[model samples]
Target: MKEAEGEVPLSGGRITPDVVRVGNTVRRPVTAASEFVTELLGHLERQGFTGAPRHLGLDDSGRDIFSYLPGRVTPRFQTWSHDQVLAAGVLLRSFHEATRGSHLAEGHPVVCHNDPGPNNVVFRDDRPTALIDFDMAAPGHPLEDLGYMAWTWCASSKPQAPPARAQAAQVRILADAYGLNASDRAALIDAMLDRQARNADWWRQHLHAPDPRVASNDQILSRIAWSLREHDHTAAHRSVFEAALR
Candidate 1:
């Protein structure tokens, strides 16, 4: 994977592979979405959004080059402290606000990170400080990212996840930190459910594809089951989430 000296192979990419670090830069294989993503990054740079990596053009191999953001990414679905959750909400709001009314919105609401799970977030000093991995960035409602964040950062159904009540409290913290309005808060749970269902459907559609985004058929199956569980779990706790938002 390393084609040159001092190139350190990086891991934890859910889609793109062969990512490597050379000095203060990261090199990743450019995908079909590279042009749009680079332009979006450039826009963020012009808008002074510092949470995302700065697109630094391309490498000699035609790979996308990005400024290396230094921090630790939390393992997926790991429970976060209230502070971490709040910090994540703040960061996401800033990201969405930065793109609001911009040309990248393309007549939509704003550009969504699409996948803003903990695994894509970079933590510094034990706080969620930055976001990485923009392969799925696209124009969408801000709630799209908020819904995905609710599931991955707070409402996970994993064994280590908090109980229903505590999880609801965590969601409230996020909503408050984001300054979400009453109408949006009421719609949050439904948004989260929609995201989980879509996630499951996406995996099912790609189950047999030769896409590197998926590791194996078994892996796809597991993700499908996990997404269903998340859906059911969120549904079961709907009342609690509603009450907390009230």
Candidate 2:
């Protein structure tokens, strides 16, 4: 089997996936569902969605290869300005829009970047340029994807909460950028809460043993709970989240 030249370990993400950089490509373990991911990426490429990496064919080691996007993933726990938050929303909406009417969305909806948080986003010139890590991508509701972004980007899970006014304003900005409808605005809070709760449950199930991965999962679970609580607080204050959007 041919080996990847000058392979260097890539940081972030759990250890099991074992992603590595080789030249201008990233190689990672292939799973049973990898072919599905490849097909999805091909569809995205054909549709001219530049927000995701182009999937290359498998390597000699049987790892899936993808064109390495030339940008950094936004660091965890980092706060974004109102503009940056708005940009994130726009980028996410673009992805959703691109997937609409594509083959991936014909029968069911397109595969969503189930985790589109800052950690999975690539930023260039301080703006989110693309999304990476399609490991969790699967057919799902667009709101489910947006809900994950709302919880993560809004800092609802952070230890130091932003002022209520600022938080509300940013939330409004994001919703406006995405052009969410009345129904989407009405469902946003519940969807966000549901996403976080589901994440906590997944972490709890997967992070049973002790390791760095376990610690990371614990932190994620804590944040998920925190975000859920914060969303509930917002709901208590406002009659409807749509008021913020309007």
Candidate 3:
């Protein structure tokens, strides 16, 4: 049992739970669901997946403690190089494979990171190496996870997003890296569209709330709208997207 050496505020999480680093551990306010997260992390560890933080139980303050993984987390909206995108795709596939046979992925549930965006990825040597923040983990279609990855990595919703052709090419790269089958390729765009719609609905529901979690709802709604429009534009040229992947 490693004792706390010191503590410092950890930033960037949207919910912004009381999170801090104590020596080699990260402590965050625990919820009723914390036990599930701890179990998930334990499953990942037993399966030999090294891409997630090791859950270290609770601290004296009753906050959930997780081993601190060392690496840079790419800031939201920051552009990534092609190689970085490829590495992210590979890492996500690895996570899916690791969780496939676990209780999380059995018929019991299809636990997904739910939010595997750049901000949640830890980069080492400029490559994505680990993922953190599994608060949104839940049962879902595996394609949903890939859709979230595509949305973030391809800059699908940004005003400065790449051209339609370029976006298609990047999507193809991601699909290829993840080893998606032809059937999966055909449904990729639709999956991404569904993810965008779901996110928009969540933000809309919270737009008028005064809670700290909803504080950024307006900005989030704007991004959702932008992303939906971009995705719609991409869908209009579905032939190009499908062709690139094929």
Best by lDDT: 1
Which whole-number lDDT from 0 to 100 does residue 93 have in model 1? 94
TM-score preference between candidates 2 and 3, better one = 3
Model 2 residue 202 lDDT?
67
lDDT at position 125, candidate 1: 94
Q: Against the true structure, what is every candidate's RMSD?
A: 1.2, 3.3, 3.3
Q: Candidate order by TM-score, highest to lowest?
A: 1, 3, 2
Residue 189 Cα positional deviation in candidate 2, in Å, after optimal superposition = 1.0
Per candidate, the number of residue pairs that clash is: 0, 0, 0
Clashing pairs in 3: none
Task: Please write out the lDDT profile of model 3 over residues 1-246, one tens digit for every residue.
Answer: 233447777775766466788788889888766878888899889989899999998877888999999888765656677888898889888888777756776563357888898988888998999999988887666789888787778746456767767878888888888898888888987777777777777667777676666457668778668667756765676787777877
Please list the residue runs of candidate 1 whose C-alpha ends up more than 4 Å from where it truly belongs after superposition.
1-3, 211-213
lDDT for 1 in candidate 3 is 28
Q: What is the C-alpha RMSD, rounded to one decimal, of candidate 2?
A: 3.3
* Candidate with better lDDT, 1 vs 3: 1
lDDT of 1 by residue, 108-221 (tens): 889999999999998999898888899899999888899999888889787777799999999999999988998999899999999999999988998778745456889889
TM-score of each: 0.96, 0.85, 0.89
